[model samples]
Target: MSKRLSVETSSAAASSLFQQCTPFGMSIISAGFQRSAQLLEMSSLHPEKTREQILEQADQEWIPGTVFLVDVDRSLAVQHEGQSDIVLIPQPSKDPNDPLRWSQTKKNIQFAILFYWSFMTSVATNWNGPVWGIWVEIFETSYSVLNDTSAVCWCFLGLGCLFLQPTAMTLGRRCVYLFATLIQTLGNVMGGVAKNVGVLYGVNIMTGFAGAPCDSLVQISTTDIFFQHERATRISLLTFALYSGSYLGPIAAGYIVENNRFGWRWCYWFLVIFFGALLALQVVFMEDSTFVGQRENETEVEKEIIAQVISKEEGQVYVSASSEKDQNVTVFEEKDFAAPLDIPTQRTYMQRMGLIERKYNDKRPWWKIFIRPSLTLALPAIVWGGFVYGVQVMWLSLIATTQSEFFSVAPYNFSTAAVGDTNFSSLIGCFIGMFWGGPLSDKFVAWKARRNNGVMEPEFRLWFLILPAIINSGGLLMYGLGVNAGVHWILPAGFGMGCLGFGMGSGGAIVLTYALDCYPQLQSEGMVMILFLRNMIGMGFTFAIQPWLDTDGMVTTTWLMFMLSVVFNMSCLIFIMWGKKWRKMTKNLYLKFSDPHFFL
Candidate 1:
């Protein structure tokens, strides 16, 4: 077999000699092509796969840059009739220098570092919610000023959420993680020793920015490490970190605050030490998670097979490369084959690192991230979930203020510390909620998806939403009534603690899962939006909460809250029923369509 081919301008060749290449070479190319076609089909018919299958597939396939391709622009990128060219570029080796395929041990360590970073960030944001009274006393300020401080802290949380995507896109996930962790730790320490409210607010801003990367980086990292089906469970676990930190924070704060000698300062000091240690751990564990290349162990035939599978699944038009270069390749090989032109020139280690940094440089502004439908939908969920989660977080204050006057007098005669103890029930509720939300959500979504003819609809994710809505409303109402009648304090405490936490967690899961299902492509953007909305909602609720309770009393205010909750819960059902329609209609407007053209 003899053929002539240009190195760079090579075109697709259909000659018989080309098809009769060496057995080893042909086998590798064929495998890669088949794999690509399968991947494309899977991505295209998503939600078609059941939950178990999805997760199973993810566990099996989710390697870094597992579905990536290289552009061979000069050639006709196509497939013959009845032959699906799944593989985009058979043996399209990524620069081995790419960081995407770092050792598993290294990746796990980085993930752990990110997890701790998030834990500290969330802790710093809400840890102060429980100790507002202490702040009022220490600063010798009016309650209004204390309220402002609280609002300020939450607003910063909001700000962090809002900026997360833009920052990640602009600064790159690694830079954001590295700097944000350092800044947040420093902020916590600074806030711990600060005497003035002004200084405290400044430190709060620092902490807020510092915390931004926790969610953003974790999201990016999750994408890096896991495939689509595994995303929810892994993201769910990441959220578990947040909830655990949030729940433990107040417990730790209450105990520390109970010690008269330690007071609130110790709470800040405690957070500082915890986060500082976390910062140190992250420095070693976390690394850049980007699309680096695979090793040669991944054979050429395997690459082509995978790429072919991906192409069909994605419904992309596949055009075959021209035969001009194919002819040249045969002749060249018969004489003395040159190095495969597809293999890129290797870079020095420093040069490769520099290239990565250059890619990390800021490209898009922050607001650009929110313009897409995937981001738009996901952001709301994040915000709402965050809002609900935050409200539950400060449930202690809401309960204390609303029920305190009633509990302090007459039969109860409870001290401040005892009031805090009432919160133990809510903590238990949170645990129940967290445990139930995880597996139930995974199972329910899978089952419903099967019932719906194997198409995974976003509505399926809303099944759990119903439980939380009813529970949260009923719990709030019970707490109000218990306080109104001055019944045994246990009534309000148990209802608020147990039911409230359960409801919040259920709602959180639905919102998160839905957002993810709807906007897998723009997940980072979606997460950022959700984070922003949630923190802002929390801040608003916290500020208005005291006033609402003061004006309407616990019973009336709680009833009103119940009504509001009912409306949103019911809306979930409506959305679920018509969600696909809504999503389709809004796909261009407010919904982010998973790139039908995307390769897994």
Candidate 2:
């Protein structure tokens, strides 16, 4: 009779706490505790189960972190008529202002615009790769000196993000996007008319800095508008645009350089014309997506409520709704409340351009932006992400540096157009990867979650890395060995280059998606870190590759690169086996360093 009374008292306390906190907060707290308890018991019973396996089980039982898991099996809120009831992780608010609540058509339109913007900028940045041979002769400079121009540009690409990210977050993405496009367009015009190598080098630095956002900002925008399940596929699409533009640039530049009527200068002229057109479209169509004020207030309220409930000194006796017999604790179903669809007052055309100034809380030190991204480099995941992206940049640089030089001389005397056309092999591979990588990753995670009883963990996505790893490693070896042996150019150019693109497309997508999944709140800063590392490493390789090739020859250099690729690609295993423990260990650190007001 006394024990029964104690149980009743505990249940009453839990009911009171539940009533105080929002359903989202309650679900997070309850799921975390329940999952922790299950892991403890499972570990004791089955010591052989890896932490990843245990975490997968925990995810099956409850959603990770503060994300509210939806019940797809029962929820009636369908995305479309034919679609099944897919669970929405980080359950969408009924608020019409919520990005998740936006009509699918609106989201798709935004994505298309962003995709085109990303593609154009990437094409402009890399068109110089295939034209390096022409530039060396025209500018009366050595190969090494001209290469430094590309290296400087790549380095600036990384450094530019240090300034761009904070400004975008504080002001608005639209403002930054327009400013970057305008500057890049002007820089291209300057580059096209430059008379000397020094002028061209300066222009490269200016344009490179302006173009940095093309790669980093798109990922942030995707996260701003899309859900977790949608991120992988969306990121894949962006990656496709990025690489396609990059490869296609070389093709176009090659033909342009080969033409007597339009030479190397015309390449820059083409970018000037294209970017000028792109800027006009951007000013007309783009809108600021940052939801700072409302999101910040909602986060504070949620935190205060959570604090009140968790501050109680009572023992761990609270009964969760999930504990009830035959009852599944679905946060979204707790109260079938729908907020009024409040339509925002439409803005004027100029207002839509986001040129109007808005006040922000600027008390936070601006230097934190620069400092925090550097600190994130200490994370194993960040370092790994850097390696995954950086290595691909390095390999591409190797090809860019060597391709024109080798093909224009000796055994197969290919014309400038032929040299440029060879990039088509890589373009095809990127297309394959673009299609295969994203959707497959999303599907893989969903399938794994279902198998684990409807709980999903980020590590489940890493399994797809294996096939790409093998393809990338094999391609590196093939390219190196074939080049050294003086085999048919197609062997290295066609098969080897194609494989590299395939691997880069797929592997790069996975690493980026993983980073976002690990720290959604700090995504802007996280991407800054990724860009910093990726470009810094890329710049270093750009500077080093020509000298290394000179010293080491094709066989030794390629073999060294191959070895590095294998080692780095294989490190995914470490994350798969112990990634959960690392996440748990860093949770407090992440919370401490990350902005508190940016809840999903």
Candidate 3:
């Protein structure tokens, strides 16, 4: 009778262990217990392990809630509780109190720093302005060589644009930030010491490449941090930095170059120092904010408390949703493999080919970024915005070189430094534009959106484009005729600055804001595209301007600019009037190829 009791007691202990291990049904408990026991038997039979060790390994591998286990000899028990049935996982909240969600005052501090950084970069880019005349005298070359060099400068920016996204993907945003600024600062330092045009060009390439990511990263950073409502205001403030730098370059460069002791190289020395300060500040204050995927390593106590806080049904729903997302989609997979559906990926053919051995969304068909209807409307706007931006930026440097010299000789007899002061007018125009255009745009956009029953169409932003159009054309006309007809130079200078300020202010704000509003998710990719076009055109036109003036004279070149300005500005209005209908007709065209979620 005592022997029979011992057998029954052993059977009862085994049954209890089986029930504890299985999460679902009674049959599952029996099956799981049998499997665990058989695994232990197999482990004991192996040459490496004793029976005791086998039983320990089996216990660890067959932990509750574990679906599968491998490397049995090395397996460790995971402390999981509750049934293996679905349960909710907690997610991180988007904290409104984070720096991204800071008040207007705090946010402006960041914007101001960024604006200053942009200003310094622009100054570095355009510092060649006052000295171009010196180059002409030294090289004894036609404007073609100068033009070609300018073309090279802009082309370098395009090359930078092409690679920035790819680099950002691999190296991450902070690494790019640190390296670009460092290289740019070094480039400026080199420029101060450069002896030849070739050296200067090489330095410009470095600075431009370093600065290329600035426009892309600043806008992206803003998007990452700010909500949709605040982006326009922040963008307007930053745009001022971009346009002001061009006008401000000559102010500092002219003053420095005018001093017999300092000379043109002094301008670059200033940039080196300026960027050095910014780099230091960024390193000290900037923190990484990439949202990390939630960890499932919560302790038993934390899990219990959270479970009590959230209902079981809600928890289950959250887990189900979380499991469906590719929160940690590996870079290799994105570049190489196809999704399970056999759908092709959206990367360029070269990108796919480069990672042929790896896999993710690789097999998807290639899709053009600009072909979507929303982006199609956006493309022209981007081109026009870039044209306006490039034209003004180049104009200041060009005038300081070609026109300033003309004004400084014989009858005019203004000093080179005096010629540099002409940029002050443009700078003043930029300030006025920033002041006038920024707030008015915000007001107009909000009001228009409200008037349209809060539907929030992108076209509402274009209404602000018209005034800047007239101002830009009018300013070009004034500046042109003032030079050609030789009116009291101030008349044309003031008009030129006013019109430029007007155009730059309105043009920069609206184009950027419109782009952001239209494609909130793809803001970074779209911004890079905008910079690509704008810089390309700006570079092309800078070289083209002097030749055009030399070949056709100031009057013809100015008039041509005026015509282009009017035609493009008018095209913006046409799109604004009909763009909503077009967007409705072709929704998610980009979705057929690229995952819109990646951008979001």
Candidates in order have lDDT scores of 0.56, 0.72, 0.58
Per residue, candidate 1 scores C-alpha lDDT tens digits across 14-132 of 34545778999888888988999998987787534443443344333322122222222222232211122122212222333333333445556666776666666767765654565
Ranking by lDDT: 2, 3, 1
**Which stretches of model 1 miss by more than 4 angstroms?**
1-108, 196-199, 214-217, 290-356, 359-420, 450-453, 589-600
What tens digits encode model 3's per-residue C-alpha lDDT throughout 513-575? 676555443455567677777777777776677668779987887788778777865667776
What residue runs in model 3 are displaced by over 4 Å at the alpha carbon? 1-99, 102-106, 138-143, 289-403, 593-600
Residue 314 displacement (Å), model 3: 28
- The local lDDT score (0 to 100) that residue 254 gets in candidate 2 is 87
* Clashes per candidate (backbone, < 3 Å): 63, 0, 10
Using lDDT as the measure, the top candidate is 2
TM-score to native of every candidate shown: 0.67, 0.80, 0.67
Residue 87 error, candidate 2, Å? 3.0
